[model samples]
Target: MNANFAERLAELPQYLSAHVVLSMCALLAGIVLSIPLGIQAARRPRLAAATLNAASVIQTIPGLALLALMVPLLGGRIGFLPAFIALMLYSVLPILRNTIVGLQGIEPQIREAARGIGLTDRQRLWQIELPLALPVIVAGLRTATVWVVGAATLATPVGATSLGNYIFAGLQTRNWLSVLFGCVFAAGLAIVLDQAIRLLEIATRDRRRGLAIGVGVFLAVLVAASIAPRFVPPGQAGTVAAGESPGAVQNIAGQTVTIGSKAFTEQYILGALMQRRLEEAGARVVRRDNLGSTIAFDALRSGEIDVYIDYTGTIWATVMNRSEPAGRYRMFTEMSAWLWVEHGILTLGRLGFENAYGFAVSREFSEAQGVDSLDDLSAIAGDLTVGGDPEVFARSEWTATRDVYGLGAARTRSMDNTFLYAAAHDGQVDVITAYTTDGRIAAFDLTVLDDPRGVLPPYDAVILVSPQAAQRPGLAAALGPLVGAIDDDAMREANRRVDLDGDTPAGAAAWLDERIAEQ
Candidate 1:
């Protein structure tokens, strides 16, 4: 609809291609494996019932829950592989069930006729049952394919770039155009695939069967060409060339570094930027991102990740299991010392950003109730509903603070961070757990309550690196200057550009780089 719309639209091809590749891989794998299983189960009634029931149970589990369960087991892994596997698991039930049903639906007389004509059981299945069952099997495939294509879009939350990127970015920034564009593109691609397969189903009927096989081969070749680049040999991922130094750093200790982050806009941008910088300095780089706070912290401790950016307040309250009744500087200083002694984690200095946790209420609600401080809100808390991110419920800052401040909400619901602001602004919820630095708080004209109990923790963004990573040449030197370059005001404005003005993350990162470089 505007220049920004066109710019975002230009990103569609790469996004759509990734989406299609992942969806197809899962679809193919699911079909190839499920068909045989389906056939076997069809011949054996008990096995068929058990297999179909198990698959149906898997189908009943929430997709996001399945993905979350997979991340820890898969080792904070990302890209297309984990998503592909999960989507394939989901695709299995429909294909397998339908194949079994289709095969059984074939007439018994046909089997008898084939047997009487001297055909073996195998020949009967191949020439008679399979041919007749093709259309129903194709229908099952079509259903699975559509489901997979839509689910693959969710892979972006784990750092794989697909159409979900557009949806996430749009939601965070309140840009409906980008969201609409992503939905339209995904739907269009699914329709095209469905039509192509429908054509194959029609052509495979009787005399035109040879043409359908040729068409499938041509499509297979096209898919292979597109996906070949991503399938590099295993060891190639972390290999470094001899004598080629990056930045001022030379050789690292025969190890590739993986820096990880939680799944959020700010976190993703910071993680990607940090990875790029480390790579530029000549060290091999990998990323383990979209990890929860506790998981990422544990990953660093276990050496699954070399480094990650965490908040000083999160460490003080969540990791160190201690709270501070002090200001930002004091909180960070105490948290930094405690981390080294208690967790053996080196807090590499603050990133000059302070993202504090606070409670927010709609402007109208606040004005109507004259609520301004934790004490004032406590009086009216019983009438107000609370909306919070999933982490907020368990995090000491929210739960402990509510108790300490004598605040009580009538009801509380966990929702995505973006939805919290929208729900509050729209008056669906009277209160929300909000970040002090979030751009949406200001954009929505919501007022934050004063924490008189000093219950909330100070959240200063800090880089936490493993003790081994600290020894790398030029690592600290390269990153030290960025400390204190991104204070509250600068961060608020950058976030505003994206959240209120619909600027893309790349555009926001560029602006941040300029600001940091200028200092």
Candidate 2:
């Protein structure tokens, strides 16, 4: 009943609806695709081996990676399409396997009897073979139901709204309530769907027409309820109107803008900031948060998102594939030009802050070991274990830093960014690739080692506007004032409010807005 919990609860209908629709659609598609393939495969041993092996291989792929791969494969399309495809593929294995088993297990006597009665092959399949196989096929469906629902949570990073949003955002902001809410609801949905299918299974097996009818009706209602919200008019029912305040800008009224945010606390705070600013400018804003780094940029390029915050170094290193170090001013200038020239993405200038990746260690360790720079750490590298978020180790920056600083001997540990600081603080990791603006740096009294070689590029926080969005009336003007508006200290404090003080991202954004206003 607290405000934080209430806020999350209010978002439930939106999140749950999307979650339900995605899960159900993916499950239904899997069933449709699998049943036919299973029938064909059941008839031939070679085909059965090929189809089952292919599905098993798909199942072997990690869910998150499979979903991530879908984004690029679908030509950078995010949200529902890619997520649905990935989940459908994931749902195939169990259902297909069960279907083949069920059909093949049917008694030869029953099939022979049907043939003896002058029943055609098709008629035998529809009347006799399928009826006997119904229970097993339904069991496969039940398993698929559980899997698709669980895997659907990982859809958040690919820009699909699901219960995974709760888990991803919760983990970043350390909000256990949100995490629990998503898990409970997702599990509940899986159980409910599984039980509903169980009812149909029983009815089919026992020849109970009424029970079958009731289950059919229940599913129809569930699907209807899940998709009903999509039909609601904007600014009505569950929708909140933009620019309702007295100070709202008139020119931008009714213009819709979509904002993207990567999966992390700072990104969430910045995203909320942009959402509020655009709303104040009389623009209806939609947010796609918890997106992966490349996914966010791709979404912006495709005009799926109007604007989002990104770092100059990320663009230089990842997007442009440049490993050479470029100073702050030169890097920003070149990167901005490249964005516009290549993809028409407009850089709105830096926000006077940098969230560069820095190697950090406990202050006590820094003092005791006399490690004040990457040079110092290099000498003792073999004796230490370095931890970082999964992406960092794979990045060119890390590769450059490692080669330059002779850190090949150091042990590497990959973990969630949320756990990096605590791991280093508790000596579970001797060092971590810490974001410079993270509030935990100060809170944990960690000392960031200086990079004497300048191998790591500067990561100046910059706002990027999509090509189509830049042409919107009053949009650029409304966002113009935010350029060079915030400093590093202010950003760090705002992040601290969310990461340590248990404030919501919106709350932290509000505090940041007030702080920026006073300046």
Candidate 3:
């Protein structure tokens, strides 16, 4: 396990590096903008109150939500810029409030004495006031440091790489080690940064030592920032792509392929597999990871992305808006026809596995209640609580599930997907909507309720490409080898490596590619 942990650590350099740069840039942006805002507000009480209130409001918006909101604002694109702006906005409040407080907290006598000595108002502020207020300002900087460093993890969802990638992928795959490693790493980085800021604030109080110490301080920061991302070396860099998941590339002998993925462990793995294969077949590859489930479809249609994988059931319920329960073959047949007709999107082929949606309970709860299936769950649904991603409660599949299984009275909680397993395992919810291949079912000793009535639609993973992408030379040949290439055991194992064993998605995908290549 320790060797596995070490190997995983070897894969995180780029992610760790990107996290530091993003966090620091956001902090720098906040300091550059908010300090001046604070200065002006301090002299005007009404302005100060309004400014503080506005910053406070920004802080209240959830980090992920704020990042997502940047998509359309930046003209329907996502990546470092949108994420950077959100981080800067989030970093502003603490710095702004503390700057105002520091400015106002100065003793009247200090300014009076400077004036008595013929110092101008501006002179007093720079010489006597700002220096005195430095400590408090730095205290705010420290708070902002901790805040941005921690929040930067959310960048992964918006298609920016960060330490959060490990946490998000791990939670979905039911990988405790991966989750713990990410949490510990992120927390460790935050503490080190805050402490360094504290030291800087202290060193600057004395002019003589501060000058020499400042160089060391910057060197320390640069070294610390550069160190984390350098661990995994070069080629192993996670293929998260850069700058809005890229549009298209011109490499691979002028052939280009864009691969996109939804925000889940399986999607990340699948996207990487697709990207790697296409690249091998002499086409340039672009990866758009962590896209919303629906966003993947739209991107493919618009040709913003050239390739991705989606489930049959998700397409049936969310995209096609059909309510009929059909066999896997029928559903795919109809879905393929509907997509080609409606949007000119093409379904290349099906990956040989079903990552189906179902209900699950802890082994303890299942055995105690003797609940073996959805029917059994339905019988006691009135007393049980269910947990899932926020989308599940409102989706057509869930509504039909409730109607068929008679689970309408069950208490429900909507939360981030990563926490559902913990919620169920810890008894926060008695049942959570579970994915069939989720590694946690075995690891955490939980039972998945049988969907005997087939309330949930069949979910066969399929390769989807835009009409434009499908026209590329050798595109079908590049992608054809993947059909029926991976089975349930293989995908579940790959997912487990990401979710539980702490492997990065690229590393996991690379490992899977090796297995397929050997065959």
Please name the candidate that would achieve the greatest lDDT relative to the true structure: 2
The residue-by-residue lDDT of candidate 2 on 1-519, one tens digit each, is 799889889888888888999999999899999999999999999999999999999999999999999999988888999999999999999999999999999989988999999999999999899998998899899999999999999999999989998999999998999999999999999999999999888998888999999999988988888799742124211122332333335656688888899989999999998877877666777789998889999999988889999999999998999998889999999999999999999998898899999999999889889989999978898898999998898899999999999999999999999899998888899999999999999888899999998998999999999999877766676776678989999999999999989999999999988887778
Model 3's alpha-carbon lDDT is: 0.80
Per-residue lDDT tens digits of candidate 3, residues 263-282?
77888888878777665544
- What lDDT would each prediction earn against the true structure? 0.75, 0.90, 0.80
Better of 1 and 3 by TM-score: 1
lDDT of 1 at 174: 68
Candidate 2 ranges with C-alpha deviation above 4 Å: 230-248
By summed lDDT, the worst window of 10 consecutive residues in model 1 runs over 232-241
Residue 167 lDDT, candidate 2, scale 0-100 = 95
What is the lDDT ranking, best to worst?
2, 3, 1
Q: Write the per-residue lDDT of candidate 1 for residues 222-275, one digit (tens) a residue.
A: 577546543311212222322334444554533477777776667756675565
User: Against the correct fold, how does model 3 do in TM-score?
Assistant: 0.80
lDDT at 117, model 2: 99
Worst 10 residues of 3 by lDDT: 237-246
